[model samples]
Target: MASSSISNAEANTNQPRETKFEKLTKRGRENQAKEVTKMEKTRWTSDAEQQNYSVKLVEALSQRSHGNSSPAAEVSHVAVRETADRLLAVAAKGRTRWSRSIVMSRLRLKLNPNKHKKQKKPKVAGDMRSKKPVAVAKKIPAVERKVRLLGRLVPGCRKLSFPNLLGEATDYIAALEMQVRAMTVLSGLLTGTESLAPQFDPLGSGRS
Candidate 1:
């Protein structure tokens, strides 16, 4: 009878310990689920966190076997792959949501007519006092005479007097002489026959 009672006490003591271990295991599983849910939430909000969780989860699975190669390792690898796939899906969903938000914002802006108009005054013929105005020709400035452009001359030579044409011919001759002098200066510089620092004249030396 005493042996039976001792056996019962041992069984009772072991039962509480086993129950505690079971509770601990259950709590661990619950905690793991909570952690996964939290990780999923973060992945939905942030790409960086999603990547980090994927890496961490894979690393945890890989380290579970402690450098031993076996069927257990293969199982761990499979688990890691599955978890990564799920997390990647979550990340993809998040990216899709972000894309939808951007598209919607663009559509809203496009649909707003008030945004297309601004402070620019509209052109109306009734708002103008006259359609055209005439002015007398003025003499070209000395600075303007030295500068030339292809499309700037008045059509039909109307701006030129005989004396102006003579002056233009003189200017053309002067330009030709200046070009010859510039070539001579460049050749002298190339042959190292000219002084390096007399006047700061780049066009004459043809450096450009």
Candidate 2:
């Protein structure tokens, strides 16, 4: 009977210690979770600071339209580069670190500091546009040259193959289009402009 009583007392004492430990661990987790992680905010500098989001986006979208068209035989990078740069500029103005596209970069990479290693870009023949333009033009295949330019157009896609680059370009273009549409609607609402809201036919009625 005495031994049983002592055993019961010991168990009661251990219970509180275990509970205290659990409470401490839970409290630590809660403290860690108190800080929320979000993308870096945009800070507008120089000319961008003066422009509103709608105007900035519209201007950026226009950059792609004004570029020189490429030969019919080859895919052109001019439009892609112009559009990506302008879209990136808008993202920068908002002080957002978009990395490459509108889709957010990985949370794992962001949480882990110094995860990205800077890679040295492979050196290529110097720009021949100013000097021996004809020779330089002949040396690099038209398709290859356009691919390189397309890679540069969309950031973080330097190594992607043509198909992948095309996919990424399409995604970037769609993202920018949506961004422009959203900004236009937002601007209209803010300025009390009776602009007609965009209409989409969710049904197949619009199709033949």
Candidate 3:
């Protein structure tokens, strides 16, 4: 029984212990994570440096603008040189150093920054004289305009032209004339009037 108990103790000792640390990913994944972290740090540094440079540039410009006008040209030259020096100092501390042309270009960009901005053309009343004459809209004839309006009102009138309208009016007048003649004859036949309906008897029975 003691030997069996000793074996059980040995078995407990031989079992693997649980680790406190988490398991790491593969080497490639670890390297990728490290690179991503490094890129983020670099991006943050670059953004901070850019913001610093922009602030310094604005301060320098404001100083130059507020300086004395008696020796304005000289003061501007001094400001440009000072700004260039500051930029060079910052660049030297960074990963990359700017070339002479690049430094000058940056200085010029800061000094003449308006050249990079989009310039809107000033609205001048005089520009109206230079503009091409706007073509006048053709005036629609009154009759044709009325006809088109009528066509919209009446679906059957859509195919009606000027000649068609005139012809339809003529036909309507003729139909009215025929109805009036028929009404007169019917009245004469009922009242036996000789003036409205002359006699038409055969063999000259009702003649004279």
Candidate 4:
């Protein structure tokens, strides 16, 4: 019984001890899904953390652009894209909403020097076309058509039939007559064509 127990103890010592944390190994294909799940929970919860991540992302991209290239070699677009994606993935911290395309778009926007620069508003074709007399003449027919339509729609406008419209016309005529009388008097004074009215005497005679 003692000899059998010694052999069993040796067998147990040789056997690998299974532990709970051993399931979390990076190389284990079985733990990949679990690892991904755990990583998905990680995120930059604060502005400072996010800012730091952004700085690292920028540095990584810069290195990929400038430092990784050999003197004779041009950096490939695919390589640049891959580098940007890797950095962005790290910055993303397994955020589900940040897909690969979104991350790349954001990365490009952030890195581009001219992203925030305001683009000049494009000039319209009409703006470039000069407002010549010919163009003005061409537009007159349209304006006349609109005015004729308005005249047809407006009451008494077609034949000046409304009393209110007639009154308005008379008022306008009266105003023009008053302006003509004032101008005639002024011209008469200037040309010495007429004597000053008694009311126009400025030596206190007009008041008396």
Compute the lDDT for candidate 2: 0.52
The best candidate in terms of lDDT: 2
Order of models, best lDDT first:
2, 3, 4, 1
Candidates 2 and 4, the one with greater lDDT: 2
The RMSD of every model to the true structure, in order and in angstroms, is 36.9, 16.3, 44.5, 37.1
Per-residue alpha-carbon lDDT of candidate 4 for residues 1-208, written as tens digits (9 for 90 to 100): 9999999999999999867677556348667777865543343333344335434544555566577547556557676555544554454443322233345556776799578688888778768454567756677777565655544543225544345444434433433343334334434544666553222422223332
Candidate 3 structure quality by residue, lDDT tens digits, 49-92: 43344445545655777775765544455666566455533443
Give per-residue CA lDDT, model 2, range 1-208, as digits (tens): 9999999999998774547888999988887666422121122322223234444445544543454374333324564444444555455443222343433433444676476666776666875344666766799988899999888877567788788788666655544555545555545554756452333211212312
In candidate 4, stretches whose alpha carbon ends up further than 4 angstroms from where it belongs are 1-50, 66-69, 72-74, 95-208
Query: Which structure is stronger by TM-score: 1 or 3?
Result: 3
lDDT-superior candidate, 1 or 2: 2
Question: Measured by TM-score, how close is model 3 to the native structure?
Answer: 0.22
Q: Could you tell which candidate, 3 or 4, scores higher by TM-score? A: 3
- What lDDT would each prediction earn against the true structure? 0.46, 0.52, 0.51, 0.49
Per-residue error (Å), model 1, residue 53: 66
What would the C-alpha RMSD of candidate 4 be, to one decimal place? Answer: 37.1
